[model samples]
Target chain A: MHLAVDISLRQGGFTLNASIDCWSSALGVFGPSGSGKSTLIRVIAGLAKPDSGYLELDGDVLFDSENRIWVPPHLRGIGVVFQDARLFPHWSTEKNLRAGMTLETTGMFSFEHIVKLLELQPLLKRSVNDLSGGEKQRVALGRALLAHPRLLLMDEPVSGLDAKLKEQILPFLARVHRELHLPCILVSHDLPDILRLTDRLVLVRDGMVCGQNTLEGLVTQRGAFDMMRRSGLMSFVSLEVDGEPVRAGVRPDEIMLANRPVEGLSARYRKPGVIVRLIDHGPTILCLIDTDEERLMADITPDAVRELGLKEGSPVWCFFKAGAVHSFD
Target chain B: MKSISPAEWTALLLSAKVAFGAVAAVTLPGVLLGWLLARKNFYGKVLVESLVYAPLVMPPVVTGYLLLVLCGRNGPVGGWLGRTFGWQLIFTWQGAALASAVMALPLMVRSVRLAVELVDRRLEEAASVLGYSPWRIFLNITLPLARSGIFAGLLLAFARSLGEFGATITFAGNIQGVTQTLPLAIYSALQMPGGEAAAARLSVLSLLLSLMALGFSEWLARRAKTGRSTHAPCR
Candidate 1:
């Protein structure tokens, strides 16, 4: 799915100016709170019209100020899973899910399919108000999918959930995008959550798209490195499937950079690779390493970097403990 | 205790018919106007609002006089009715219903507007995003959510219609077995010396009915106001 947004909107006293041209089945929009991330999601969902620009989603003109064209939200066939899980409180879970389905719904994403996919069978007859936070979010996600939308817009879908509930809902989000092949724009302030789904990231700061790149690519930019450090730049890694494929993560702090390979070491991953870039902050330098399989980021002290002579194109081994590779299933 | 005389029973039945007819006539229009007033902002909003509420603040006599001029025989609406349907509204039971509805309209509008405004707007927007048309959302969400408020408003309007007098007296007249509602019957009874016992009985029933209507309406409104389970169990 491709989206082109060159728009400016003034809401109250804040003006949001964003220009993003991205194509990804799972596009992640990451930003801090009050950075207009949700506003961007709303614009894409056609919930809010841009003041003076154009928006084309998958070749459909959603909004074009110059042409006097504006598509209504329901006509856009774009579904939104709001942050607060705005399910109709008076309706049952089954009713809420069916609310998104029209007569045109085909056999692909049928009622039984989504119900089984989201595991909503047991909760179908229950009142929406009676469901737990995680369950409500799952229902909200299923409802949006049942709409059969070309693009799904989720604004802080799991931000309101607690840590345990968030852990419960993330897998459903991943399955929706991966198995169903649903194109979604997931907007959230949490970086790790977005990384868990897709690395194709759009960084929004102060109502503007500060940078747009994959999580690995963004790590190489000096400006992006410092900003990402504030949010803790822990890059996601797709581990090779021995029997079952599992997505793993490596925190920048867990990675140790070495100039020469030592004979004995307990760290599981010790691959000799080339250093692509170096981002120097005040006390430490963030090294971007390109292994044959993936790009890894390791944070080491300036003293270590100076001693090892780690620079662009320098050969080094990125080491991390076996336990440091956190698996997401 | 003596049983109700035929005249008193006729008067009682006519009052019920007029009040029931009045409530029925105003309900649909009242709800529409209430929703419009609560949701829309357009040209001459204040003027439209004031006109809807004018009957509430103005003396009932003035409203009666206006209705009399507009709907009386030889008047535009009365003449059209006479010509089109060969029916007359002046000095009839339907005329009393018209007067009662006019007097009770403001109460209905005010109650329904407040109720519709209290419905969560986000829910409606969510329905819209879920592919519901505005009318369907109103039918499925807004109306059900505002049900208690509307019931309270209807009861209040019914109560107001039950006791309507000045306008009914002016426009429909106090003819026996026709427009002589409970209050009109009581007013007629008080003028005669031997009508004391009958008037006393009818007056007590009227007061009791009014109090009961008001009490039930208040109870329903308070239940909704306290955020209770009336909003629960809506399919």
Candidate 2:
């Protein structure tokens, strides 16, 4: 099912005036903190009400302030998994899982099925706190799924997880979208999450939709550069090679020394630029390179620096493959 | 030990009856007022809160005197009740129980109010989403979660009623085998010549009963706290 939301809410000095009319199989709300990412989802879920707005889910008008019609969150057929797991402490993992299910919506997604889907069988007897961060998030996902929500809203579902734990849970989340045939709006600030989970991205900035495009298309836009500047980073353009579409993402440590236009064997996306500055960082120096209105951070070892005779104002031909480009928010 | 005399037994039985009756009288209104103060934010919230706590802070005799004026036979409400329902409250066992209920109402309300405030609004929202009506939600979810606090309040109210003195004596008068609750009996025993042993026994009994009630209240609070999950389910 598709969801449509156009809501405006004011909190102190910040005003969130968000309007979205897109329909996607999966939509990702990608933004930095304080960008009203959570507020948008909360408004749609009825957790936080917008002062004046209208919400229609799957062609049903869930809320319209003008009409004074408001459908509460539970009746909206939407499920939300907050960043914090919010598992009931008093309940066992099984009981907490069961809490999301009832007789009216029975058998849509069974308790056993969710337990298996999230690999929750081992955790059934454990208290919510007894489980690790990854386990709690999995249980939270299972609980939301058992409720049989028409559409799911996940707010940074893995923000607290370490890299390894995040890797562990990402596949399960992907499977939920695939197997359940559920439309989802996933909110996060992490680029990897968007790349791994969603095709369509909605970028929010200062409580407004600054841009909306595919992950690939948005990264190519000027706003991407602006966002990168705020992030103290730069973009490495992806190129097409041998009829195979290749994308390149710049890592801060991958650049090597090249004084002249060295004939690279097969590296794609060759860009000629000058080293602008070098900041000493003990064994390595942070080399700032300027290429076509873009600044990239490259960490080169002192040995590589001495061998290449690299210095500020030195012209260099950076050879990197287009396959490394990662299109994420 | 030995069996108590009939006079002492009479006082013990009377106190038990008064405490029970006081609980019955105060529970419904106590709960209502507690919920009102806890959940609502209407005008005069502060004034109502102060008025409810007045008996707790004010001299009990003053509260008893107020009750006497309002619930006495010739008083406006008392006269109306007498005319319509043939109910008379002044200087009777029922009047003593009413006085005790007034003295205990604030304690009952404060505990229940605190519990009601702690009931998560998100859970209530979750209940609504689950197709439960507001009344059903209150009965099933809210009440169960707040039960420990309500029971603590009830026990406190009952204990307060058992030991109620100034209000009961002032409003109902200390009549032998009638409105003479434990405190009133103890007061009377202390005044009578050669009544030290009986007074000491009654004091010990009061102390034991209060200690037991206090212990139970602490247990209930601790149980409620331990039952709390670090991450309670979101609405």
Candidate 3:
């Protein structure tokens, strides 16, 4: 299913002109904060009115400013999972999920299945406040799924979670995309979430969509690499090496005392990078590697630096597994 | 000579009757107004809110005088009612009830309005997506969720009606068995020569009734908070 949206809005001095046309089952809108990501999602969900726009989902006109056709959120058939779970504090988890379904819902996912999938049975009777951040988000996802929306709009659903918690939620997101056969538009600033959940990426900058393409295509693009390099969201382009792929990523904490280049199947891409700066970061030493246009941060133990005789002007080969280099754009 | 007088008992019953009558008359409208003020954003909303709350902060005597001008016999509305339906309100128990209702209207509105404002609109939207109509949403979601505030408003209105003195006396007058409410009877007892003990008794009853209403309101509010479920509360 394809969803098309073209909208423009101006609030105070900030003007947002954004448009997205995607055919993928899972699309990611990647942007920094205040990049109009929420506003764009709101417009798509029919929660916020755009000054002028046309939104069509699967050839059905949801909003056309010219025709004055503005369907409210309920009629639009789009389920939204806000950053905060936004669960009803007055209803049970089961009821919250049930409330999303209509009497006419046929062939939709069952409430029981969702409860089991989200592991929400234990939380069904508990108050919303009693649930943890991760559990609340899981319930929120279930609530949206029970609605059987044509398109799911999730705004930074896992941005608040730590790395491990985010990883735990990622599989559920992938399951929704795969098992449900539903198209989704997820908005986030985290590259890892986009990498884990979506194949298509839409890069938004200054409230305007600057790029939209496949993750692989975006990864190879100069602008994408430049943005990540500047923003501290590191990306290393992976190319096919032998039958598998040679991948690379920055594990800033992994650089250690290496007198010589280590050889093994684990080192996916070993490139000689120049150490441009060295600084003390508490107990460890932070080595700044200048790899062409991108600067990589490596956290090396201070003892490793002294043993390796590494300084600002030394040449060291950065080594990491190909798996660490995420295929996401 | 020391026993509770029949007239005093009648006055006590009449106070309760007027209070209940006034509460019944204003409840649905009070809730509607409360919801409207809490949720709707329209031109002149502030003006409408100011008008609804005017009786709360305005002098009770002035409000009673306004009621006299509006609903008194031979006045515009009173004249129309009397002419059209032969329904007279001046110096009647119904008239006293109407005066008490006016005095308590803002209290009812203010409490319920606060409750309505606290309801989460997202849940209401979620209900709409589930095919519930706006009215159904209000009944199933908004009203139940704001039950505490609404109950508080109801108690405040009931208590205000029970104690209403100035407007009740001015609009309906103090006939012992008809319009002499608790506050009015207390006033009468205080004014009568050597009626100190009777006045004291009436004051104690009024205090007890007010305290009871307040206690019930607090209990209902606490119950609502504790009973709130984990699911979406508003819708």
RMSD of candidate 3 to true structure, Å:
8.2
TM-score of chain B of 1: 0.90
DockQ values per model: 0.46, 0.18, 0.30
Q: Every prediction's TM-score for the first chain?
A: 0.89, 0.72, 0.73
Better of 1 and 3 by DockQ: 1
Q: Pick the candidate with the highest lDDT.
A: 1
| Window of ten residues with lowest summed lDDT in model 3 chain A | A248-257
Put down candidate 1 lDDT per residue, B1-235, tens digits, no spaces: 5777899888878988898889998899889989999988999999989989999999999999999999988899999999999999999999999999999999999999999999988888777777777888888888877878789778978888889999999999999999999999999999999888899888877887778778877887787655432245443
User: Please, what are the lDDT tens digits per residue for candidate 2 over residues B1-235?
Assistant: 4456798788887888898899899899888899888877999999999988999999999999998788888889888989999999987899999999999999999999999999887666655544446676666567767777888889989999988999999999999899987788889889999888888877777777678767977887787677665334233
Ranking by TM-score: 1, 3, 2
CA lDDT, every prediction?
Answer: 0.85, 0.78, 0.78
Give Cα distance to truth, residue A227, candidate 3, Å. Answer: 2.0
Residue A40, candidate 1: how far off, in angstroms? 2.0
TM-score of each: 0.90, 0.77, 0.81
lDDT of 2 by residue, A127-211 (tens): 8769899998998888888888888889999999997888668778888998878888899887557656775778888999887
Per-residue alpha-carbon lDDT of model 3 for A76-115, expressed as tens digits? Answer: 7888888877776677766766777766774668888888
- Chain B vs. true chain B: TM-score per candidate: 0.90, 0.88, 0.91
True-structure lDDT of candidate 2? 0.78
